[model samples]
Target: MTAIALKSTLWSLSIKPFKRKGGTNLLLNASDLALGLRGIGWNWSQVHLAPETRPTSSKTTFVLWTLASLCLHIPVFDALHYAVQSFGPTTFGTINGGSIFDDTLSPLLRYSRSTFISFLSGLVIYCAIRITYDVATVFGIVVLRQHPTQWPPIFNSPWRATSLSQFWSKRWHQLFRDFFVGVGGVPMTYMFGRIGGVLGTFFISGLLHDVGLWGMGKGSDAVCMIGFFIMMGFGVILEGFWRKVTGHRVDGWIGWIWMCTWLLGWLNLLVNAWAAKGLIGSLFIPDAQRLPVKIFGPLS
Candidate 1:
């Protein structure tokens, strides 16, 4: 609710008065004014129509793609449910001890286990976000008769991203882009220029994510959560420096390795923090619906 309120306030500050085609004013009609405000206010992504709207054939193609995405994510989500239960919560456990890794296993094996858990947890999060957005797209296009352009994909192939900046700006979900710009980037830009805006945007993002953790009972870990995001901001800056020196964009096999190393290296901090707070153990999916959980009855 706090997040929604922040977005709403930003929207009100940014929105302009409604206009219509052929010089007619939507402001004159009370019903039209209310509907327009509601629609624009609710669209968090701020997807807008281009001068040339898509044809019906494009809509059909979108529906097919959305269906394919849903098919791919459902079974992956189920398997993730199984894997997470098998591993138990807290990959490295708490600072005082009591983690899944606190066993008689070799140090190398424990590190590998923790890495696998971190990647698994990240995949589950990605699947959940994709599935929810895909379902919403289907409902909007099929049931509500909305245009395909209005329901653009929430993600843009994040796995293909070769740099932190590309990953955050182009590949990742952009539902909060304007919110971050409004609350952090724009204000900081006035005082400290573009780089400051970049840093500020990430700082605010980290703070809000921790706030979300706080809302989820015992999930807040400001140090890990905020530190991870700030590090990402610095990573983006480092990439920019590399581009300046090399005169080449971050891409291809080498860039992919660098990106993976950067992300996976720091991923444990955020994932383990959530695990320690009991976020991973929370019943996200009911056992009856999870095939492996139903058969094995949850490993630990």
Candidate 2:
């Protein structure tokens, strides 16, 4: 329901006509117009009929690839899900068994545990999104008879990102690119310049995320969501400053270290906020259906 609402809202805000073939289309009747708008709303990335080099894969190959991806991701997701469940929901900074904020533990142990949980939560989210994208791509190509080009890979090796700008713009899934740029980036660019545009886009992204949390009855925390995103925007700006001063782009091992430190260091703002609200207890896959849970039982 949250997704549908958000997508519908994005569609409403879209200025361009999301035709399968771009440009003007003749709508004979109200039904045609309605269906056309519905189709546009359904296409999250607004993919259309466009010429591209990548050829469509065989049905057999597609099935095998998707299956392999699921085989790899399912177990990973299940393990993280089990671990998250074990931590259980935090209540007023306390948990049933243990927590990242447990004062009884040493400072090193607490920080390390929090960082690990944050990393696990991030991976779990990535797996869930990737699996969903793969299944949806298959359904679109095989069942709906949509062109494979319209369903390009949703992600492009985000973990390899060496810079904040590269991570957000090039590597990460750009499903919300158009929406963010159109609604926030463009206007801010006109008003205050490129820096403002970057900050504004991140601000909107943070706002939307917190809104989603609020819609889910989790009670939004602006400090967690908005603060994290704004800090990321500043990180991108700082990288730009470094390049200007040093005449060297942020890349290689040094860049990777800096990126990891920035992300992981600030990640707790979002992760701990969700954990406090019991979001970590939410299960992605049922325990009875998880192979690892069946074989080895839940994590201790």
Candidate 3:
């Protein structure tokens, strides 16, 4: 039945780039289009690529996935809450005449606790978000027959990242990576080469974080996050220089130790600020109620 189907009079019925010859069947044509995109579509700038897909997940598998995400999220949230403070007017952004140093906790205890919290927040939160997103993407693409594939581009085994540069560029959550690069890196590089690009990218990220804090009504404290990214930009430059000098990157267990130490050692600066503003503790019970019973259940 050669009817006037898929020939949109309002729009141009141009052929797609991936269609094979003599494939007039609209259903098969669409399927080929999807497969073609899934195979070749990639964005190096954002480092996002489609992953291989299964036919569909079983109903039980999908349910289990969701339950796992929720189950994991509670503990993740609790840990984050312990590391930081509850959200208040000052929970995110920095305020005048206030310092996390001024908090009651001594430097020893504060640093130790905040450092542990940071690790948990970094690891668990990223995983939780990834699992949840992938599950949804799977359902939409495979189950409902909507999108092409379900691979996500956010975190990519960041815990395995051997260096700060790799962590930021290749592994860590890269949701805003392309945005920062395009808005700041590209033009700055054109103007002043790679260094300019790095500075611009980190600067833009800092501004974005500050703006986000403001949007959340915590604009009063923006310096800490800004400083954090700016420092990261410089660290990247230093690492690049080191690589050029040494002809190799800081890799392996030694590199991992270096990376974690470098990040966590200075974490007190940012963590303190986050704690002061209650951003770290914004998820669950207050520090006083950080007991397992309060977080889990009544001793059952």
User: How close is every model to the real structure, measured as TM-score?
Assistant: 0.78, 0.80, 0.65
- Candidate 3 residue pairs in clash (backbone atoms < 3 Å): 84-280, 84-281, 85-278, 85-281, 90-277, 91-277, 93-221, 94-220, 94-221
Tens digits of per-residue lDDT for model 1, 1-66: 555665666658766653433324334344333323223324333433223222446777778888
Cα RMSD of predicted structure 2: 5.0
Error of 3 at 35 (Å): 23
Clashing pairs in 2: none
Q: lDDT for each of the candidates?
A: 0.69, 0.68, 0.56
Summarize candidate 3's per-residue lDDT along 142-209 as a digit string, tens digits.
56554332333445667787988888777776655554776678779999999899988898787776
> For residue 102, what is the lDDT in candidate 2?
61
RMSD of each: 5.3, 5.0, 9.4
lDDT of 2 by residue, 58-160 (tens): 6556656766777787788777666655554344223222234667789898778778777877887788877887787677667755555556666777799
Model 3: lDDT of residue 266: 61
lDDT of 1: 0.69
Q: Which candidate leads the pack in TM-score?
A: 2
Model 3: ten consecutive residues of lowest lDDT: 1-10
Candidate 1's displacement at residue 184, Å, is 1.3
